[model samples]
Target: MDEFLKWYFSDHPIVAATLGADGYDHTLGDWTADAWHNREREQVRWLERLSAREASTLDDAIDRDLVLSQLRGAIAEAAWPEWRRDPSVYLGTIFTSMYAPFQHRLKPEPELVSAALSRLAEVPGVLAACRANLDPDLAAPLLVKRGLGQARTGRNFLTRTIPSMVEDPDLRARLAEAAEPAARAFDELVTFLETFECGGTWRMGERLYTTLLREREMLGYGAAELHEKGRAAWAELDARMQEVAVQVNGSRDWRAAMEFLMDDHPATLDEMRAEYEAETRRAQAFVREHDLVTFADGEECLVLPSAEYNRPVLSVAHYMAPPPLSSSRQGVFFVPFTPDDFSPDQVRQRLRTNAHAQMPSIAVHEAYPGHHWHLSYIAENPRTVRKVFRTPYFTEGWALYVEKLLQEHGYFDTPATLLAHLDFRMFRAARIIVDTALHCEEMSIEEAESFMSTKSSLSPGTAQGEVNRYCAWPTQAPSYLTGAIEIDRIRESFRGTLKEFHDRIAGSGGLPLGLAEQVALA
Candidate 1:
């Protein structure tokens, strides 16, 4: 198992670096077709070897299953032809490879700076491989446009953000020198994408989509059943939101209540950051006072502004988990306040999307007792497989579950705050519908955007941005609600205190819903 893990990390250095694995900081992944084929062959061999081995204990069996699931998922992904169809795959790889070294403080600044330079030197070669692997005819038009946007973002990061992040004159000079060619490489990619003729569709279709849910995600239901489940969830949540709307204001119109809450947001970015930070602290205190779960020692969650390049796509806020293997278990909760570059209307829309009343739920969801809290415990687990093999179903589901748990515990006693929490839940419920519909060819992208806007009360721009994400990442959108439902089922069956149930499920790491139930119930 350890030998297979070492090879897996080495073979996928970008992923390893993202996961905070050492010895991969100076390397980037090979995106060439030959590399893909080689890795696929290697994965097959490892899968066979692991499968043939008998498990010595329950922990061993679980670890073997986790590794086997990852290998199967990777092999299945390789067969999807995404490398040939999506330029964004390569562009995203470049951004993550460059970003991870700087984001995590696992190594010294000098070593990280040197690693960044090494990766910078490889940027041109990676872009060349991207150009060579992608077939214009097989590319989706939306993804091609997205690739161009990402290329521009990458160039901006290389020429601007990277330099600003470095303070030492000598290191800054060296970075600038290496970054020039990388910026030019991004420019070249932008040009290629601009002229790229694409005829492919973004839909994964029912068969492939179903395979992803069943095989990759290890979900029991297929896409069709999941779509129906989404519809049912949306209806239930919509009804609940309507009831909460009446409690918030003297009316049943949820949109009106949400708009009222939006109007009460902070006037400036500095104030917004302060608000989030305060709310995060409040949530943390509440959890501790309630004894919700065991807090990991030395766990710290910092609420800060999102990086400049990430603001355009990040919408409102996101959580950055600490590296599982790192000595520092400090997570970052990034809030993307409205940028000064946006027009007056755009700025208003952005602020409205992240309203004042929503801060508590958002803080609870992304920070304390949500991603940061859950992931901190996972990081402390003795099993490396638990740390390495995570699924959105577990991670996202746990976060969503906590949001409701807090509400039930009277943490969100205020009608407006509870309404905000329900609004977020309704949005996830809507995501299930849109995600299944889009990939199953039941709805068009335009329709999905409209459905999201109407159901979630999201701005057109925000809805479109979200739909694009769903198109690029199939089967992930449904994980939030699906995982929450599964967790609720597990908790219902668990014969323990609420804190014990929370601790047990979270400490088991982010496993598949089935495996999570097994561990939690055991």
Candidate 2:
């Protein structure tokens, strides 16, 4: 199963990588639609080649129905893609960076691009074949419309998002030059769509659309449930933030407290990077101390400025892919270079982002004990089904939960630093309200932005980018809060049951800590 699962995921690394890119946490149409369709035919062919027995289970029934339900729903949702008015719609970032490697294989000419897209149209037929074989009926117009609405929101992101080095004129100039390649590349893809066909006998409607949500939920948690979890988790974190805020700035609110800390705790970009590297090394030490999992020898961290290809202006910081499982090398924690114009105060705020993305607990979130640890473990997983089926929500949620866990474990001793963690949690929780309200609850983009800025006191520029991520991708933003909440609940339930905190990590080597009860539940 492990061998097979590796082969399976490796077969679609491009699709997986594209999906892994950022969203702030929803599946934006532009980032996914073209590549998604491009691979559908190949996926179908892959499925057809699988022996019926091989297709049926990784070993035994790993909730096979749930998997099929998700796949069918994806087919349905892809039928009538909508175009939104957001800049996130067009440019693929780190998540979709995998798409870049394939670009050199294509011609820039519109005719050639069109022909390629037309060839991709063959996917619908393959989907139809699957439908003929399985005859799934999952009609949910509202769900399909939800997809269309999401696509509409993403349309704006395609054309005019800025470079990540917002304050650097030279890099800024370099980025603009960089855009030439990406713009031309994206235009070629868009041009291809003109003659592209969506074939297959399977109709796109309600049932199929709903199934996608259901499958994703099975992989993670239900959307409505996730929102509730996010809200509840936010409330708890808010209470904690209040405590920390008072400690930092007596009687002041979180906003004033954060500002005070930013002003007082300012660090230069170089100083900030050094601190991040030190913090990350400390995290690695913790992982080793706990004997949590295997580690790469002398695994150096990578921290660099965000590139122009995918990173848009107002971007904070993010991580890149770790070394492949076979490589046995450490992953990178990329810190986008700050511009000279950024105030010391601004740079301080950016430093907090390192903690969010790279701290030991965050390392657990991004590399070991989180994405890398678990992914690497699963890459080496004995169970084929488990290895092949990657759950983004589970993966991301676990990482977010790790950040919170660090604080709970008395990791943040400083009042200001603690405030940063609380703010991060709030930022994620706010995503639930922002994403759901924006896409599903009919909130205008401005209303969503206002909600983020006024409610959180985050800078307007940051707030806009955050809201755009939620807008472009729908259910995803809530996952950090939701996934973290779920993991917390499970841990609380097992507080006395487990002998050691790190022991739990060892016990559930490749599975999510949150799902420990599922086997019993099943």
Candidate 3:
């Protein structure tokens, strides 16, 4: 299993780089149709080989099941026609290939720069492969527009951001020299995407959607069942939010209460950053004081501003986990303030989205005892498969689960803070509904965005971005709610203290929830 895992990582450089695997910084993945087909064939053979083997112990059996699940998911994802239809497929590869080398300081600056330049030289080839793989007839217009936006972002990163980030004059010169062609390649991609006659739909349809839920996610329920579950969860959360709203502002008008809380935001980006940093510390202390869960040794988190390039896509905040394989274990919590180019009104809107009332919940979800804390343990785990194969079900679910855990433990003590937390929870519930509806041919893109806007606290712009993401990536948005539900179920049955249960689950790494249950309960 270790040998196969190493081989798989080596064969896919982008995946390896993202996972912080060594010796892949100077390379990129193959995006050719032949490469995709070849990978599928190899994975199938491994699947067959692994399926025939029997395990001698529970741990070994669990490892085998994890590997098997990963293989099946990879194979199923490969069979999807995304490579032939979605321009974001190649655009994402391009961004990550260039971006991964700079993400961590595992290597010296000179070595990382060299690796990045090497990738920059390969960008034209990647774009060429993208040109060859994509068919306009199968391309969705929304995805094509998104690809164009990403291409522009990639080009700016190559031409403007990379050069500015370098301090050494010689390295800066070399990087600038290498980035020109890559920038040009992006310009050409933008041109290609601009002329693309996109007539295709982004829906995965019932068949592929069901297969992903059952095979990739290893869920017992299908899309329809999940959709119904989402609706029920939404109704329940809605009722709770209404009750909280009455407590907050003496009315059942939840939206009005939410808006009032949002108005109480930090006046500037620096203030926002400070609040989040403080909240992160407060949450960490609360966890330790309550013995919520054990933290990994040397795990640390830093609050920072989002990169200029990332601000376009990341409306508010996000967490960037350390590569499990890298020497650095410091995670960054990125708070994206409105860009300088935005108007004053736009800035206010952005600030409102990351308001004071929501800071505690956001900090809890993205930093302490959420992604940063959960992933730190995964990084410390010895098993390669445990570190390599992550499902959003466990990862996002665990984060969401901790949000509620903290709430239960009094981290969100005020009516306003609790209401903000519930609002975020309701957003995830809406995601489950929209994700299933969009992919199952039940909702159009506009309708999905509208549903998200009406049902959640997301701004119209953020809601549209969310919808676009759901269209491009299926089975992910729902994982937040679905995974949380599964984790709660596991907790209900576990015969242990809350801290012990959390430790067991967090230490188990981001397995599929079913397999995660086995590890947590064992």
Candidate 4:
């Protein structure tokens, strides 16, 4: 068994890095079994390819140890944080990313989804046993939220909207029409999920967090002092936002100016969804015209409204995970489709949210040049343990950086429109402060919410909700601020080093979609 395990371990890193999974694939689920099968196939492909890459003798004990070491390292690096927090649920995140795109492709029988989820439920135990043999100091953190962000958004979606939709036959029919096959698969998988469990409770302690922080730093950050840096960064972004607000509203107070933008075009949910779809198309055109980034063949994206049950009561907006690499599914920008009575203004607010969330610049971050792009690029690039080991700061930082780059490059040609972009950037920065202060520093949620409201110009309700999420998952929110800052630094360094070569950053075949085009240059 150990020898068999060693052979398995040797191939696992390639599988993890080349065929990676994100967090949502763990916590929230789609209604399909085929997704699981697709992921399994990815693992198999990774193993077969790895075997072909290294013709080294596999019969020796030394080869076995070497292979096993790499395998254990990959699993430990990715799974330990969760295991330390709770040995039982560590595997939840390991399998999450594979579900959506994989399922979309393989479309396995529904029973397969249920069976696969049940099998995954036992992964924590297997990981715990392996951890017993490994060095705790070198172990990985379980569940990095980057992959899981969508899951959090999805959980919020189901908890809030499913009940109401179920009550309305017509609406429920529409939802099922769009989501049934996925939902049914999800229901089958959920039976295997431990509903009573709290994900954070199973997280690592100070020591583990410190170790993970070190691993994160190795990815180019100077240190793991997220709290102080996050606060200071947020403060700076607020100052930038203030300047934009003044530009947009000459004599108007900045706070009032932001609110006016929010209140300006309040509409029904349907109207908001339509506007979102339109804005994304416009944003894409802007990217093409300015030569910001290139979209790959078959990279079709969607801007749809979020189902009522899944909408966050307090979250102004969120982005869904990009589709898996092997399967060419476009990412979706989901807006909340609330009723007309629920603050008709909320609908209009959603339009701006969608514009920011689904913009081509954002698509670059979340999809093309950001998350999806980075992941796909790394998949085909050099083989390093770190390749499979993503640092959220690097990934998220690049995304945030892209958002600002779009604004600077004249994507926001109008004042009021650009003001909204600044406001959103400020909101992201405030998230850094709110998340850091609430978690590491032990600030109360209310205090954090107040800080967000005043600094980011968010509503009290929305502010509270963002604060809550940061509290539930500490260190995660800091990724945006810290990530953007690092990406900017890298870009500046690259520009200085290769001033004439900067155009090479976006040249064809530089880096695949969704990853940082700049990182490839770096």
> What are the per-residue Cα lDDT tens digits for candidate 1 across 1-522?
788879989888888887888789787778788997898899899989998999888788878887877777777776567888887788777777776567766777788789999999999989999888887667799877777766777777887787667768788888987899999998898888888787988788888778767776778989999988888988888788889898878899998888788888888777888999999999999999999999989999999888765665567688888888776688899987654467878877777788888889999999989999998888999998799889998899989999999999999988899899998998998999999899888899999999988888688878888999899888889999899998998888999899999988899899888778878877
Cα lDDT tens digits, model 2, 1-522, are 344444434544444333231221112122333444565665454433442534344225443432343344344445433221222222233224322222222223332223223322332232222222221123223222222332232222222334331334554454445444434444443443332333222122233323444554443434454556667767877787788788877954877776655454225556655655666667657766745446434444555545334344435555644323333334455555554456666555556444332233444456445554444444443343443344445567767776766666566667766787677778788887666555555467788788787666466656776775664455557667666666666666554433254334322332332333353123
Per-candidate alpha-carbon RMSD to the true structure: 1.5, 10.2, 1.6, 9.8
lDDT of 3: 0.84
TM-score for all predictions?
A: 0.97, 0.63, 0.96, 0.61
**Tens digit per residue, CA lDDT, model 3, 1-522:** 888887888788887887788788787767788988887899999999999999998778878888888888878777567887887778777676666556666777898898888888888988998888887677788778777766767777887777777778899888988898888898898888888786887788877787778887788988999999999999999999999999989998788898889889999888999999999999989888988888888999999888765665557587888888776688888887665577878777788889999999999999889999998877888777788878898899989999998998888999999999999999999999999998898998889988987888877777777788888888889998899989999999899898889888878788888888888788
Off by over 4 Å in 4: 1-103, 106-210, 217-225, 307-329, 336-389, 495-522
Q: Model 2, clash count?
A: 34
Global lDDT for candidate 4? 0.46
Tens-digit lDDT track for model 4 on 438-496? 54445665688788878776667556656656644555676676667655655664543
Give residue 20's lDDT in candidate 3 (0 to 100). 87
Range of the 10 consecutive residues with the lowest summed lDDT in candidate 3:
307-316
TM-score of 3: 0.96
Which scores greater on lDDT, model 2 or model 3? 3
Q: Rank the candidates by lDDT, best first.
A: 1, 3, 2, 4
